[model samples]
Target: MTRHPEVLWAQRSHKIYLTIALPDAKDVVIKCDPEGVFSFSATRADGESFKFDLELYGGILLEGSKINTGLRNIICSIKKENKVWWKRLLKSEGKPAPYIKVDWNKWCDESESDTHDSDDDYIRGNSEDNDSSEDDGLLYLPDLEKARRN
Candidate 1:
């Protein structure tokens, strides 16, 4: 029997990111259609077969999509036909498959999407500012020295 790999997905307005968590995959085959159908198949190093099919929430730009295979996963960058936020990854109304999940690390809400890009530009434009007050939105541990003094 074929096993299904864990699929983690996140999205921006214009694109979707699908990360297939399958280490050392071999004979990988992936297909995405303009009509929002996606198929994937691969074999693990130990000879286990893995596969899955998904009906995406919206049409995709097959020509603009890209796939990158890595040591631990395969990342597929799918370009959406229309630049809009999708409510969910799959087209179905109910719950998604057990193996499918949201990729919180890469998720960006629609309201934050615009600011997300600008934040990168801001960091690059202000590289010369090294003051502690100018942290680029990253979380840092509390300064123990300052706390002790207080």
Candidate 2:
């Protein structure tokens, strides 16, 4: 399977949802079960290919570990795509699905050629930002036990 142009990206949250147009094949493979270890290929209509296999956490985490690693890899991969397909997807679609929004200024900087290291840096920064926001969210929410008792 080759990565399709349709796949602007994917999010492996409670469930895996892709911001991609449903391929003619109707289903896309996700490496969620084994957690951080996964391999899948997608093909564009023109036969271009994108394949990924991730073994994050040194391949030794439990279910939560898998979920976190999978999510990280997925976002990093999409960010490397330069967000070009995202614009195309928006132009042809019903509504924009949530994708890890890329920082275009940093992403397409003239000093940087597209490369894995740069993308990794971006992912690291993005993850930090996400953590801060999630922390703020927790502060505003009622305690889980109290809510459950209510």
Candidate 3:
């Protein structure tokens, strides 16, 4: 059975950081549609294979996108086409997806980066700022009736 590699992602002002763990693969195949659809597939030397696809929130500048590898990890930096803020990395029809874990140690806050303001607080420890941000940090909306009963 081919297993998909674990993926971790984060987004900054103008670009998104995606890291995929490709244990034994030295090469990978990636495809991106001009409309912000992205897919990556790779087969490792040991026969492990991975494939993942998703739609991005905003269009990307494919020409400026870069993919690199480090310690069996395939890292991709995708540049946003419009240089605008994406409330969510990918578009969702209903409730937004769970907030992604940002690699803070590896990522620097780009204050000068014009894509967005530093208004999001996905961290669980800080609940005071949750209401102010567009995303509530809850994967799904709370039940209004349940809250009222409580």
Candidate 4:
């Protein structure tokens, strides 16, 4: 069954993990802060998890803001193993089709390795076509960093 975003889940203090099953692979734990910022971890179904900051546009907007707010859209690029499943899972919620890589840190770097290659016409074409730098993947901050420094 597809889970709707409006379904309000219990709120936890940066520790509550929501486990959602992928199509044919391991289930990933959705971890988030009290404010609703979310990150995913996949070390195990239930174990030491590494929080990944992979959202394309920083944070998801839960409510409509004066400038921009309303049902924040989450974004993340998954690994090859999880791509197919993720596509199916997020087909609904208007999820973008793997634009920028934030969750897969290693893959993102690897994919961009040839950006400096001189022979590759495709890479050169990209540079010539779009002069501006693409979004630098996603920025990940440790949960501790979110703690209020009182």
Steric overlap count per candidate: 0, 6, 0, 3
- Give the alpha carbon lDDT tens digit for every residue of 1-150 in model 1: 899999988777877878899999999999989999999999999999999999999999986566767678887878889989899999999999999998777777899876653334222211233443332222123569999999
The better candidate by lDDT, 2 or 4, is 2
**Reference-based TM-score of each model:** 0.77, 0.25, 0.63, 0.19
Which residue pairs of candidate 1 clash?
Answer: none
Which runs in model 1 stand beyond 4 Å of their true positions? 117-150
Top candidate (lDDT): 1
- lDDT of the candidates, in the order given: 0.78, 0.31, 0.62, 0.27
lDDT of 2: 0.31
Put down candidate 4 lDDT per residue, 1-150, tens digits, no spaces: 222221111111111112222222234445433233455544333333333433322223322111101123222212222111122122135644343222222221224434422212211112233454432112233347558653
Give Cα distance to truth, residue 31, candidate 3, Å.
0.6
Q: What local lDDT score does residue 6 receive in model 2, on the 0 to 100 scale?
A: 31
Which of 3 and 4 is the better model by TM-score? 3
Q: Model 4 segments beyond 4 Å from truth?
A: 1-23, 33-37, 43-51, 55-58, 62-150
Q: Candidate 1 vs candidate 2: which has greater lDDT? A: 1
Alpha carbon lDDT at 50, candidate 1: 100
Model 2 misses residue 149 by how many Å?
39
lDDT by residue (tens digit), candidate 2, 1-150: 444333333222111222323343222355533333534555444456655543322222233221112221222222111222122212224544343233332333232333423233323322433543221101022458988899
Clashes of 4: 3
**Which is the leading candidate under TM-score?**
1
